[model samples]
Target: MTVHEDVGAFSPDSEWPQDATEWLMLLREEPDDAEIRARFEVWRSASPDHPRDWEEITHTMGVLRRVTPVVEVPVGRQVRRRSVIQRIGLGRGRVGLAAFSLAASVVLLAFLGPDIALRLRADSVTGRQEVRTIVLVDGSQIVLAPQSAIASRFENGRREVRLLKGEALFTVRHDAAHPFTVFARGLTVTDVGTVFDVDAQDAGRVTVAVREGQVSLGGIVSEHSPILLGAGEELSARDGTTETRTVASTEVGTWAQGKLVVHDWSVSAVVARLSPYAPGPIMVYGKTLAAECVTGIYTLTDPQGALRTLADGQNARVVHATPWLTILHR
Candidate 1:
């Protein structure tokens, strides 16, 4: 059995019995085959989970589609006269590369929509020290920072949103039957007549911070706790362990107003929080620089400016590798 099958396959062709990856690749070469086509339909309709997986595949295809439109090359540049030797070798290589690329594209297309929708978007933020608010199409709001992205799809029975990457605070509009749901890793945060924020980061870690109303979080989180969270309450789960803690809701809500406040926070902690706002890496070279205590409230629009302001207070010099990377040394 192939690894995907050995591990339990999602949509493998049982007749051909190809691995999930290979099955996807075959669709490119033989998309018209009735057996493959029927099997594909069966796989998608087999369970509720299949459509979600398919959505991820479609989003990735969108990325490739957008990227493929822009290409620049000088056409018909005669570096050398077309010789028989050059033609034979060049043709073979070109055909091989094309076939390989096509196969890869099909597999990627299978998981593109849902996965990419959950991860990439028109805009995204990561490791931000400040709380940033994003306005959605249906007049809802998303407060994102500290490695977060929010993607929305106005679908029937649900105005759905997939938090593909990072952490985000969601203020959803009230809809009884058509609830707004946020998907993160293995967990799903569904609003139960309320507004909440969910922080889903790398390593299956998730934090649900509620402001107004209550939310129900599902998945095998923890045995000791209930899944419901009310205002001023937060749920944090790392692997199998889960805990709920009460915090100042107003403090977390500060992101909605475009402010992030920090007090006596370690440089590592600050960087961990701040990295989400700036698009690229924010790293400190020395322990002295990395361990410094930071205290302040700053706007999301200007992270580098915030760094400069912080440097001025500490009497330190700020050196930036690029526009996005900053390093402070005394």
Candidate 2:
């Protein structure tokens, strides 16, 4: 039997668990690299504990594979992966280079149930540090931010897209005969021949910002009398409350261009926006530190510098520069 099926055959020594896990992730990332395989053979023979540690990871992955194997992010375009969570803890941990959440997949899967379910329903997904532009059959364009997913349904002469996770900017093509609508959370943004950005990243909030033209927001707020937003206007809906504010239209969806624009956003929120582009996890500790507000345009290409600058402004600091993690504390 294969290594995965014989988990009982090997009693894991746990001596080189971390090393073995890292090696497994690396190998999966470069399975065809003969050099890496050769080096792995050398390391495997270095100690007997190594074999058991490696076997333990195989068992874990095998279990996960059997339980929830593939995630098909396919419709009519190209996708990066079709299995496991791309970033965060597992799938591509150590900041997208290795895996760290496999051992804790069961616990994480519990917490990530909703997101995993969303991924299963998604038609397009952008992994960590990936930004993708999809052109539909109607010539409309969709720019998905990092760690984002969307599912589109174009039937009955109407186009509807659901923002599964993260964020996306839609540039709709004018179709008077057909309507284009985007759904997120409990809000529906119906395009009025316009370009708009929908963000569902903030906790319990789906933000709609119009870059050009107008869009009516229905659902949660009555489809009969949908709220209308013009160019340069933005709306945020959360719980039962809705808030509207005006921002420069040019600044909307700048994250797709490697710049993050935030206004009066909490320090914790700003860091959350930066985490997808970062090489490691960015942790903001303490409620007091998390509550402070920040407003400015930060460079996403240099996430480290941006976080440091943001922290400096709040009299806070970012510690622990581990390649896979960053900690922010007062």
Candidate 3:
């Protein structure tokens, strides 16, 4: 009997059965086979929760089999196997197999939904206060800002990037045969051999700023015309409304150089942008103080000093409640 020890890592407290589903699927396909049953017994005893999850899954499958009837499929008839699994009930072993298939699908979906699946699929991620640059297979470069995540794929004459969170600046390599496209926050930005910055923050808020060349921006939610942008162009989109304007091309992606240039941006917005660079949380107590706008180029090398400069300029009070907490009040 051969035992496969190469099964991936498993956490006892994980919400879903990790590698156990593989064992279950194998058993379901060959229930009467003794080898798989023996291997499953070995795997089930490896951890305490493994047996508990297996028993619960078995109970669920039994309940499903009791309620669902199997339909007969004609021999030599064309039918989708996945659809057939839900409709057909053979003998005891086949019924258990079908039940297991249905239960496994539900378990996997509940455990690894869209967000977790994306995080798992991401090719690279940047932590807080960390910036990373990745050179793609096609010679394109992407600089990921703090706390950003991205997945890239180049196949079938197309280059694609899915930005999961935070910001990224793309310096695309011109490939006429394979156009580069970026997906983020229900929006798509297709590169036209240009350098552009994409900021995908919380609540479906996204900002795309062009530093060179041109690109097309469109919403994934509705059928809308693509907004074209050139050098020094900027577009901000939130909820459903989108606004486009002009910015200094040289100052567009200055954060990559350890500087942040803001032109008359509100204090809250400034704090929000700086929070990613700060070691801890920056909270604004008063709405009026947060709404006050300031314009300047701040050095990210000293986040606390930048905060102090903003506070002193606006006559606002900076309270250091804790080493990790900075509060601003008017």
- Best prediction by TM-score: 2
Residue range with the least summed lDDT across 10 consecutive positions in model 1: 90-99
Candidate 1 per-residue C-alpha lDDT over 226-268 given as tens digits, one digit per residue, 9 for 90 to 100: 3888899988888778888887777665655656677787665
Q: What residue runs in model 1 are displaced by over 4 Å at the alpha carbon?
A: 1-139, 143-147, 151-156, 201-204, 222-226, 292-295, 312-316
How accurate locally is residue 313 in candidate 1, as Cα lDDT from 0 to 100? Answer: 71
Q: Which lDDT tens digits does candidate 2 get at residues 1-330?
A: 533333322223321112455466556655565545655665676678778767765775687656644332222211112121133224212323233333223333323423667678999987766789999888899999888889999888979999988899999998878889899998998999898999998779899999999998999756688899999999988888989999899998888788998889898889988887876557675566789888898999899889888988987656532355565655
In Å, residue 6's CA in model 1 sits off its true spot by: 68
- After superposition, which runs of candidate 2 have C-alpha atoms over 4 Å from their true positions? 1-116
Clashes of each: 28, 0, 1
TM-score of each: 0.53, 0.65, 0.62
The Cα local distance difference test for each model comes to: 0.57, 0.72, 0.69
* lDDT-based ranking: 2, 3, 1
lDDT of 3 by residue, 1-330 (tens): 235453333355432223433344445555565544655666687778777667654664566446544232233212233322332222111222323344433333222323556568788877656788999999999998877899887888879999998889999998777789999987899998899999986566888999999998876533577788999999888878878888999988898878989999999988887766766556665557789999997877778788888888898766543344455654
In order of TM-score, best first, we have 2, 3, 1
Ten contiguous residues minimizing lDDT sum, candidate 3: 87-96
Error of 2 at 311 (Å): 2.3
